[model samples]
Target: GEYEVLGEIGRGAMGVVYRARPVGTNLVVALKRVEASGLEGTEAVRRFREEVENASGLRHPHIVPIYHVGEQDGRPFYTMALIGGGSLEQKLGQYQADPRAAVTLLAKVARAVHYAHQRRLLHRDLKPGNILLDEAGEPQVADFGLATKLDPGGAAAGGPMAGSLPWMAPEAVRRDATLTTAVDVWALGVILYELLTGRRPFGGKDRSEMRTGILQAELIPPRVVNPRVSRDLDAICRRCLESDPDKRYESASALALDLERWLRDEPVRARNTGRLERLVKWTRRRPATASGLTFLALLLVAGIVAAVTMANEQDARLRQEVCRGNEFAARHVASTVLAQLQHFGEAVEGTAASTKLTEACDGGDWPAVEELLKARLLDTPPGPGAPPFATAFVLDPEGIIRAECPQRHRVVGGDFRDRDYFRGARARADRPEGERVHLSRVFTSKNDGLDKLAVSVPFRLKSGGPVWVLGATVPTDATLGVGGLHDKARKAFSVLLAPRESDGEEYVILVHPGYESREPSVPFPAGRLRPTETGFAADDDYADPVAARHPDYRGRWLAGFAPVPGTDLVVLVQQPYDEAVAPYRAFFRKFLEWLVAAAVVGALLVAGLWLSRSGHGARV
Candidate 1:
């Protein structure tokens, strides 16, 4: 380095820039010394010489002209004009305050870049530090440290990797983009953005992030950061920073014209830009925002899946619970109804008056039959809380009501052939002695006008000479007494008792909570009401019951069965689907609300953490 070093003017990762003079010449110069020992070997020396030649190739008033190049003591040094006004980096505060003046300076710098492009020179490292201002305050594009010669045919400029990472055009960084004047134009755009906004477009915390930002990050327009920057300048800056090299200005000369237009208050060449183009530039400049949005979108999707799965699982669990509760309830109801039937059957057998009553009715002694019915049949009170019997009548073999005991209303000669109770007793007339009484299939009683069950037994005047049927009708609802079991706090349920056979072979409604709540006064029309199933008494163990559909309710109900002992009767407890699954719906709704709140909080926490960590390492 054959120069008298005056003082350190600046220092960078490469080496130190100093104010110096040649051994023989008294001319003041800015000297950059490439310490080969640190740079290591022939490649560093070659690159050092290239930097000098690249600057010397083109001569222009606004371009820092290289005056000398040489090597001494294993070191390489180059000399250019001593820009007393310092780098554009230091002048940013002053120029950013007056955007018009800043644009004027950048326009001149752009022309200097165009001059180098004319000579097939590409100054790929164009940044604020690379641009200098002379004593007269005229901008001079400097630092050809990473410059390359554009191919004469405008093909790619392939050489050693070079350029300021943040300011380098994406194609130049890749070293595959065509080595054309557009590369210099892109660098000029970065310089102008820094000069006007007092900030760089890329704010990545590391070289890797910087490279990505340059390649794909959005550019924050000059006007956005600094309102003093006009829309024309904003558009001009974007045109140059285009990710596609082809989309950039054809040459630095073209960029200079657009910037000049802004200074002249005329519309810029980048006027064709639209919202989409601006948005792309903004996205590129803010990589963190894009990545954060992508991360939250994924979290949102995952949360939705989790909520749906949780709701389904909860629904399943609630249904199982409802089924278990209904199982216990069904057995309780079945036992109660069975007990009432057994009690009445025993009373009839123990009373000798019942046999006398049957004899009197068969002998056509109407007066004695009436007295025997009152003394033997109606005297056995149905006990406390038991469903009262509608009537006790003796049906002769011809199926006529002979005598009604303590009975009101009318004719003792009423025909009983069509009645369910009479038919049921007659059917079981030849039943074995052990299987004494017959339990009638459930039916709506025409007398009391409620759900009723007929339990009957047969007797002979003289050892099967002629059979007579003795029967009683009991209201099934009062006998079962299960309406209150349909607890709101628990779950909705229905209870049914269907005798083996007797009435149309259809198991009938005994105590349905759904029905009672719906039509308390209006009786279910007999034989018109459809049964949930047949052969309920044959079921041996708990199984999935058939779903019963009723238009009186919201949805279908699932039934669970329990058979009563020593009887052809099955008790069923049922529940609607919605009621069974209500708990699940409530739980999932709360969980979803909490999940959404947590997701939003998590997103904010991550974003804040990133900002806190990145504040110190922001690219200058």
Candidate 2:
């Protein structure tokens, strides 16, 4: 509260950093807001607090010290000592021309990083901008925002990707291994190289190109770019930029030691590889040799490419036929089941509403309505494969349970005014006279612990505005089994009944063979019936990967949906992308293996031919 408002110093995804001064004190400080107000959450706040604690614990002269950590308006904020001198990024051109000063600055930053590592703190992001100079022109490490602790056993971090993309290590970019302190070491190498050459080692115009360069581009030696660079300094810079973390300096301390040696004109530990090591490293280091091998491999497989192309065409044709057949079957099945349920409900509504029972229902006289229902309506059979109707009931305008058929449970006087079906039917009362029976969203019964939906119709007193809702609770499986939609033929596909959530715009799984509520499951049961991508909000992004594939499967998928007439629900059908691409992927994998074998054979033949010719020349 004592700090006065000041200009913003930096802004990032997490929050903003500002340069502020205390009301009565001469000292200035940097204020970091953990996250903006709109982004507040329990998890986000917890992570913010944890990061602040991690940064506050470091006590090195080159490391910035946190003065205070506090929260305002549900957002956490921390303050640290403000460095007066500009960041290392601002001094790149100045340092690039002075080799001694560049190495000296890098050595100080490296020593600070090593100090943090000793405390198990890994500063995942180590670009030049994060290193700032104090008032006396001394380097001080700042911004531990992306920092994480290193594993004692040195296992890689399995967390989300950290750090700027251009300076990221290959392992961090690929996300194939756990992150370790080695990532920071790799970033420092990049910083040192950038400072020495006035540009990034793997420079590109955009992030995608930068990522490709980092993963595949070879290092351009500093001495070649700037001839004034000494061999010792060049070797030190290259050692830090080694693509493999293991090949780079083992620790920040070791990098500092080498930089110090280069400054003092002493022989550095880093050097060019011997002949045998160079021969082994030739394929990796020499892009030309690798490119030639790749060219020969492609030539050797040219003949087989035609065969693979034909196989792919055949695969596409087969997939199209399969999809057409599956859709026809699912549509026929879904329509059949929905028709039967509507027909049954329509019959009951016709007979009961026309009789004197209307008066009893309108008056909320449940006992009278029960008698009228038994005397008039015939009991629907527990069909050969169908689930028995769980509930046949009527609700008054106030949504109280007035009558229950089959009267198994004493629910005649209970309240159902808060139920989804009653609410849905009432909402439709303003619609044209023709459309009114509203099917509720599927939900778990609070009492019975089962998933079910209510098909409800609103009726009036042959007259007035008071609406009575006739409801029936039907199990989801009953709708799915309408025409054998989940039969043996559909083993490769998934067909489900989905409904929009009443409380939100997101879609929720109502019924499917893969659903836990779907008993006597299907052949290829999905791991999760609930879709991470299913929703129908106004501004939903259709291209989102989650919305593009079935949660149970990976890769692209083919999905189609048909609305259930008279209701805001749909029959959703989904099948694996592999169903269409499996044949292609399979054929290609085998073809690739064969091609690789041919390429290796061609390489050996060329090597033998070269050796034989050289021996003959030597003999001459």
Candidate 3:
């Protein structure tokens, strides 16, 4: 027959197997050829012939049948049904074993070994590598050269010792020079252990370590390595690896019976220790892998996002609190100023002598009224002059300054007709018995000085006609504390008061403390003041430059067009972003440290388990 030889299917210690197609049927078949070098002498040749004869007699479906055994081209050769699906070892490595699939495949292998045993043939090597998977993925045990015929003195010279050392039974390792089905049972247990845990039971760094460990050390519980393995499955694996052959299943059939029972949900004969059983249950409950860690990381990220959202909410609330506090203070100061103005109006109205201007207007005759005004209507300690009035003045219906305190820089003759404060007061005065003390909107003073707030009240004569306007001035600085001029972090803040124009534009009127003189100063037009988005005109009223930039200026500052309680003025407070959230920053850093630490600990645990298993495999 014209058979085309393809490639080698697999190689073993004794021979090589090749895939080939027969010419007659064009069907694939595996050919096993014993190397001539391996059959060195007459004794080796005789041993090869014996193995061939033994393999040719096996006819089970799970056992690879030897179709022909002959001498081809001066080399001993044999042909069998070629397994299209390759070896069991390859499948095990490629696909992680599902418990059901593992049990099914294992049961098939056990059945094959049992059939061989019943036929008086013991397969000394029964490992995954020797178990071939056909095109249908069914297990077919091959490489029966190491098979012991179970007849006294019929086993080959090197047969028992020829199998894989790691899969060898304890009796085989000790060179007990015996042939028994128990050896096959031990190999089956090792294969089951490897399938469940992805590793060998007993192994360490070197061959010596593996040999010694396998003989002395206890196997790592399968559930410890693979939590998916059931306690009953683990018990089955441990029993097969028992040192004493007497303790092992009597035969492959008996082993298969127990495996079938386990598959059927029936309890096997094997006993499970309390801790080992608990570990198996735990593994089934939650696999000890990075998947859990991955889930935890996702939860942690979600928590962090939630925490950040809450922090932002808290930050907004704190900002509102601070703003509300400043507004309350501004209203309190304005109310105090309004009350003083009302008192001043009553005193002037009550005294007819004071209402009429005497020809000689000397300081001593008006001392009592002057003293009264200075004492009640001025800031305490009043510097070193008559007094620093708490309100700025605008006069009569024409809107001009009549009298001012701190007599050193008298503004009595100054005209303020174009100012918003004067116009607003004049309009109020026109009303019949209108508001006696009219509060004005916030505006910049034409006087090239720091920003000041003005308060005006009409003086009604005995004849029922308006006489003059009495008022007072309060500097922006005195109303808002020096600390309030800077941010909470102590960063410097700038203020500018500009007049609003009819064209909707505003022009700079006064730079507080003359811009250049303030500490930690801000830049401004040095030459002549010009109109700008930030600039205010003399007749317009607005908040300081810093306050104007605020989105909540109308609601928070309580100054400007809206009159604050006690007085009419706006107050602004600015702080640096870093200083505003310093506490939160510190908290975030601590949280980050804890998160990193947790990740490190989790990674270390995973790495340690991985390395330990790798080391165990290396020894095996």
Question: lDDT values of the candidates?
Answer: 0.68, 0.70, 0.59
Q: What's the TM-score of each model vs. the native? A: 0.43, 0.48, 0.42
Model 1: residues >4 Å from true position, as ranges? Answer: 1-287, 349-353, 371-379, 405-411, 418-420, 432-434, 444-451, 476-494, 499-507, 512-559, 565-568, 575-590, 605-620
Top-scoring candidate (lDDT): 2
* Tens-place lDDT digits, model 1, residues 332-395: 7667767766766655544423566656766788778767656655665554445445566677
Off by over 4 Å in 2: 1-295, 301-329, 347-384, 404-420, 423-436, 441-451, 460-466, 501-504, 516-557, 584-586, 593-620
Model 1 has an lDDT value of 0.68
Ten-residue segment with the worst summed lDDT in candidate 1?
Answer: 538-547
Give the clashing pairs for model 2: 156-178, 156-179, 157-178, 157-179
Model 3, total clashes: 20
Query: What C-alpha lDDT, on a 0 to 100 scale, does residue 188 get in candidate 2?
Result: 87
Deviation (Å) of 361 in candidate 2: 3.9
| Model 1 clashing-pair count | 8
Q: Against the true structure, whose TM-score is highest?
A: 2
Candidate 1, residue 154: lDDT: 58
Give the alpha carbon lDDT tens digit for every residue of 1-620 in model 3.
34677887767656777888666676777877776575545555666676888788888888888887667666677788777787878777543458777778888889889888877787777788888888888988987777767764333233335667778787777677665788888899989888887788887687677778768887787888888888888888888999888888887777888788888998777754467678677667546454556566786787678768877787766555544443344344335433444544343222212433221122223334334445445544223222244443325445655444434345556776776556655556545443555544444444444444455555543445655555554443322222233332344232333233222233332223223222221222322233234221111122334333334322222121112234322222233344445677788778867866776787778767767877898999
For residue 61, model 3's alpha carbon misses the true position, in angstroms, by 1.5
* lDDT (tens digit, per residue) of candidate 2 on 501-520: 34334445555654443342
